[model samples]
Target: MAGIYLRGKTWWGRVQKDGQDLRQSLETRSESVARGRLKVWLDELEALAWGGKPRLTVNAAMDEFQKEHGPTLRPSTVRRYGVSIDHLDAFLGDKLLLTVRSSDLKDFETARRTAGASAPTVRRDLACLSTVFGFAIEKEWADINPVIPFLRQRAKRGLRESPPRTRYLTRAEEARLIESALPYVADAILFAIYTGLRQEEQFSLTWEQVDLARKHVTISAETAKGKRERTVILLAPALAVLKRIPRHLKSPFVFHHGAATTTRGARRALPSASTKKDNDGERFNHLDRGLRNAAKRAKVPLLRWHDLRRTHGCRLLQEEKWTLEMVRDQLGHRSVVQTERSYAFLEVEDRRMAAHGPGTNPGTAAAQEIDNATGEPIAAQKPAQGRRTDLEKLKKSTA
Candidate 1:
C-alpha cells in the first residue's frame, strides 16, 4: 500500500508505481505533520505518473478555476471574483499551490487588513483563494485545503465584521425628499420605501412582473440575488405610486428616464470614443444625479438610494413590528438571520417596552423618539405586529 510509515523516529512515504519502488523522507518526526507531507508527496507522485504538472502555481490554479466555473456564474459575480483574484494573486500567484501553508494565508489576511481592506473584503479574498485551493484539490494537484482550516481558526478568534450601515429615513425626511425629487425619481423613492426592493430589482422591474390586483410583485429567480423566486408585497404607498405613474407606450420598463433633451457639450467633448450612449425610454442603470440633486434640495446629508430600501425595512419592523422571518421574506433575503443582522437594532425599543410592561407602547407612552435621519424629535409612529392579520389591518386603515 502507498502510504506513510514511521521508520525509527522519522516519517517516510512509500509508493510503488510502474513497477518502480519510490520512497521519500517526510522530514518531520510529528505524526500529524508527516501525514500532511506524505499526502502532498503522494499527490506529486501520482501527477508525475499521469504526465500532469507535479507543481501547480497559485495563479495557474486560480485561472483554471475561473475558466471552469466562470461561465456558470453571473457576470457581476465573475467580475467580483476576478477582483478578489487580482488581490490574492498579488501575494500568492507565483507560489506552488501545494507549498502554501495556513500560516502564509494568515499573513496574507493580516497584510490585506493592514492595507485598509475592510473585513468583508479580506473575507471575500480568502473565499476566492479557498475556492482556488478546492479546485486544485479536485484536480489532484493539491492534497489539502489550507485555507479552510485557517478560516475556521480565524472564525474561532472572534474577528468582528464591520458594523452594517443603519441609515434610514424618518417620515418628515422622507416627505421632504420625495417633494424635492424629480417626478420619476420621486415615484421610485416612494416605491422603494414601501417595497424594500434592491436597486437592481427596482430598476430592472417591468409592468409584467407587477400584479397590482394581487398587491405584490413577483421577483423572477433569474433576477433575484439568491437565485430564487420571491414575492414582494405591495404596501398601500407602493401600490399608489405604481398606479399613478404613466406607462410609456413603447417602453417595457416601469421606470424609464423618458428622453434626454438637455445638451451635455462639456461631457460630450471630453472623449467621443470612450463615451457610451445611454439607452433612453428603457431601464435606468442609476438615478444618482437626480437623487443627488433631490437630497441637496431637501438638505438631507449623505443620503443614498439604498437608504430608501433600508427605510422600508426599518419602517416595517419599527412601524409595523413584523417578525424577522416576515421581513426576511419581504426583503427577499435567503434567511431570517440575514434580516435580523440588518434590522435587529430596530427591536431595542421593543425590548425596552417588554422591560416596562406588556401593554406599554413606547412610541406613544413616552415622548417622540429622536429620528435617526434628521436628528429631531418626531411624532410617534404607530406600530403593528405579525404578518397576515397586520397586513389586512394596514390595507383597511390605508383604504
Candidate 2:
C-alpha cells in the first residue's frame, strides 16, 4: 500500500513493499495533487517491474551499436569513439539501460570530473550516450532517452575553452627538419608542406590522381575528409618533389611500398611484391621515429605532424598574392572560414609586410633623380648679380 503524508510541512509519498519503507518527495503542497502524482509514479514503477518485456542492458546495446556502425566512421574517429565507450562501460558496469535515472547520469558526471576529465571530454561522453540511447529508442529497445535532457543541460553550459595555440616551426627550423629527415621520408614531408595534405592523404596519394601537365592532384571523394572530391594545384616545389619519386611500372601509388588504399582499408590489403617487407616496415617505423628526431635535431619543441598542414595554410595566407578561397581549396577545407580562422596568425605577418614599403633599389633611385621637368639633373642656380655683371662686361667690351 502507498499513500501521501505530510512531513515538516512538505508532502511525501510513502510506500511499504515487503515490509520495507519507500519514500519519495512529492514536490507538491496540495494533498489531492500529491496523492494523484504519487499514484501515477507508483503505477509506472509497477508496470516497469511486472508488465513490460525484458529490456536490453546498456552494455549490450552499445556493443551492437559499435559493431554495426563503427566501420563506417574514419579510423581516427572510430578509435576515439571506442575509447569514449570503453570509459563509459568501465564506469557504469552492468547497469541496466532502462533503469538509468537522472541521478545515475549526475553521478557519472561527478566521477568523470573527479577523475580529471575536461568538461569537453565529459560532454563528448554524454553525447555518445545520447547517440546510443537514441538508437535504442528507434529500435524499440528503450522507452525514452535518459541522456537527452542531460545533453541539453551540458549544451547550455557551452563548450570549454581550448588550450593555447601552440607555436609552429619557423623557416630556419623547417629547413633543419627537412634536411634531417630520412632520405625516403623527406619528400613526403616536403609534399605535405607544399600541398597542405594530411598524413593520411599524403600516404594515400596515387600517381593516377596526379596530372603533371596540369600541375594538379585530384583527391578522390573516398579519400578526402569531407567525403567530396577536390583538386589541389601544385606549386613548382611540389612538382619538383613529385618528379623526384622513382616510378614503378607495376605500382601506381605515389608513395610506394605500402598498400595503396585508405587508412582504414590499408590493413586489409596485402603488401605488394615491390614492397620489400622488412625494408618497408623499417622505413615506416623510421618515418615515425625520424620525424620526432628531426624535430629535436632542428631544436623545434612540441612540433606535431599536423603542424605541417597548419604551416602550409599559414604560408598561403601570408603570401601577398594568395586569397582565402585559394587556401580553402588547397587545404581541402569545407569552408573559407575554417581556413581563415585556423590560420589567422598569417594575417599578422601580412600586416607586418604591408607596413614596410617597397625596399630601396639603386636603379630605381637613380632613375627617379633624373627630373622630368628639365630633362636633366637639377644643379644649383647661378646668382642673378653674377649673370648681370657678366652681361654688362660683355656689352662694354663690345662697345
Candidate 3:
C-alpha cells in the first residue's frame, strides 16, 4: 500500500513493500496532485518489483551506455558520440528516460535548428539520442522508443535535405588540375582517381598494407568504413604512383609529407623529407587547402577531393562498361543497388547512345541533306517503308 501525508509546507509520500519502508517527497502542496504523484511513484515501484522498467534519467542512461559501449567504438566515433551526448544533455539531461515523449524530441530538434544546426547535424544528434533510448529499452529502463516514430514522421514530410552531389572530373579537367597541383597532392589525386579510395582510407594507408608483388593494398576491417576488410587492386597508374613515392624511414604512412616550413621563404620538400614527426608521423592530413589552391591556379572552380574518387567510379561505369555488381565490389559498396543508384543515369545515357547509333540521331542524314540549287538544309523525311508495308497488308486483309 502507498499513501501521502501533509507535511508543514509540502506533501510526502510513504510506501511499504516486502517488509521495508520507502518514503519520498511528492514535491507538491496540492492534496489531489500529491495523491496522483504518489500513485504514479507506487506504480513505478510495483512495476520495478515485477521486473519492469525502473525510473531512469536521460543523463544516467547515457552515462551507462557510454560506459558499456564506448570502449568498443573507434576513437573518432567515440568523439562524435561525445559531441552528440553533450548537445543532448544540454536539453534533456534532467528529464526521465521514460518521460521523453515525441513532442519533447520535436522541441529538441527545434532548439537545435534554432541554434543554427543543419538538418543533417540535428538528425545525427537525434539518431545518437535514439540509440541511447534503444539501449535504455534493452536494459528495461525505458518502455518505448519515441524517437523512432518521430524520425519516421520527419522522413515522411521530407524536410530540409540538400540535393545529392553527382560531380565527376573529366580527363582534361583531371590533367589540368594535376599539372597545377603540388607534387604530393598530384600523387594523392592520381591514387584517388585510380583506386577510388575514400579520403580517410587513402590517407590512413601504410606501407605495410601494400603488397608490391601482388599489386594490391589491403584495407583492414578496423580502418575500413564498412568495418569489413577489402582489397584495392593497384592498376598501372596507381602502382606507378606507389613506385615514385619515396619511403620514409621513420614514418609508416604511405603518403607522408615534410614539415610546413624548412625556412621562411622555402617551400615544403617534394617526394619525402627527413623532418621530425610524431609516433604516427607527419602525414598529409589537410588536403583541401592545397587542392583548393591548385584548382584555383588551374582555373577550375568548385573542385573537391571527392570529385577524384567520383571520377573513378563514373569512368568505370561509363567508359569501361562494367556491370553494376563489378563496380559495387570495386567501390567497396556492400550492395550493388548503391552503385546502380549513383550511376544509373549513365546507364540510361548509354542505352540512348546505342539506340541512336553513336553520335548520329535517328534521322540525321535526311535532316543534313542540302538542296543543290538553294544550298539550304531540307526538312528530315520520316521513314515510310515499314508504314507502307503495314498499310498494304491491312488493305489486302480487308479485301
lDDT of 3 by residue, 165-260 (tens): 777775555666776666667778899988998887888889999999999999888767688898888878899999977677788888766422
| Candidate of highest lDDT | 1
Worst 10 residues of 1 by lDDT: 261-270
Clashes of each: 0, 0, 0
lDDT of each: 0.76, 0.68, 0.75
The candidate with the higher TM-score, 1 or 3, is 3
Clashes of 1: 0
Clashing pairs in 2: none
Cα lDDT of model 1 by residue, 249-289, tens digit: 78878887552212211111212233345354677877877
- By TM-score, the candidates rank as 3, 1, 2
Candidate 3: which pairs clash?
none
